[model samples]
Target: MTTETTETTGTEAADIQAIKEIVATVQRTQRAKDPEGFLALFHPDALWTTGHGKVLIGLDAIAEFTRAVLPAANWEGEVTYEPVHIQFLRPDVAAVKVRQVYRSAEEESEGAPLYVMTKRGDGKWLLHACQNTQVQAG
Candidate 1:
């Protein structure tokens, strides 16, 4: 699956911020139980590996999984995603490190995910490959 690409912003800082916001949208979409909205952040051929080690290749696969699980997820409280780091692999590619935090009255936990994004020819950053990992307290 391929679609038109989007070019990134002029400055690195601006690009980083934009990409971070895109990542945060994942948290927002999940919290709102909007699977399609969450899936919209990814590239058509993007790969996503779940925290549970399930590998979803391509947006279609990701969408299927998201539709099946995201809405049924019963986690209480707000889920948050914060970008901790951003590394540019190329002018149009980035590796973003994110911190995913889930906070509720009963418990608080975190997930560490690395999202590889690409600046499309149209100037938007989209997730290319992502790995979701649960952050275990040591």
Candidate 2:
């Protein structure tokens, strides 16, 4: 029983690390403006809500939106994504809260995004549902 518990804990730790890698990839792709690379992190049936309130459903919609906007975005800055929290809703599902920041020589902006990820049977985690919200400056 102790061995089983230890194994389970180890697995969860690995899962958390994998999830953090995904968030790091997100930041990298965003910085590179690689829409396809960014899209690859999502599930085929994923749902996404942009910071501007646009809703995208499924991989097709996400791909279309990303291809249209990501490359054209006019931002001369560096973007960063940090996984601020993770909650395991089930053994194969997790809700991840991310803190996103864009910093340029002139200004800085922040985003709060929540990503619901699911681990596939093949042991890969994909973004299933996500919401990106811009942090309004006070």
What is the TM-score (0 to 1) of candidate 1? 0.90
lDDT for model 2, on a 0 to 1 scale?
0.91
lDDT of each: 0.87, 0.91
Cα RMSD for candidates in order? 6.3, 5.2
Model 2, span 1-138: residue lDDT tens: 011112348889899889989999999999999999999999999999999999999999999999999999999979989888888889899999899999999999999999999999999999999999999999
lDDT of 1 by residue, 1-138 (tens): 111134545687678778868977887898899998998899999999999899999988999999999999988899988888778888789888888899999999999999999998988999999999999998
On the 0 to 100 scale, the lDDT of residue 128 in model 2 is: 97
What C-alpha root-mean-square deviation, in Å, does candidate 1 show against the real structure?
A: 6.3
Candidate 2 segments whose C-alpha is farther than 4 A from its true place: 1-8
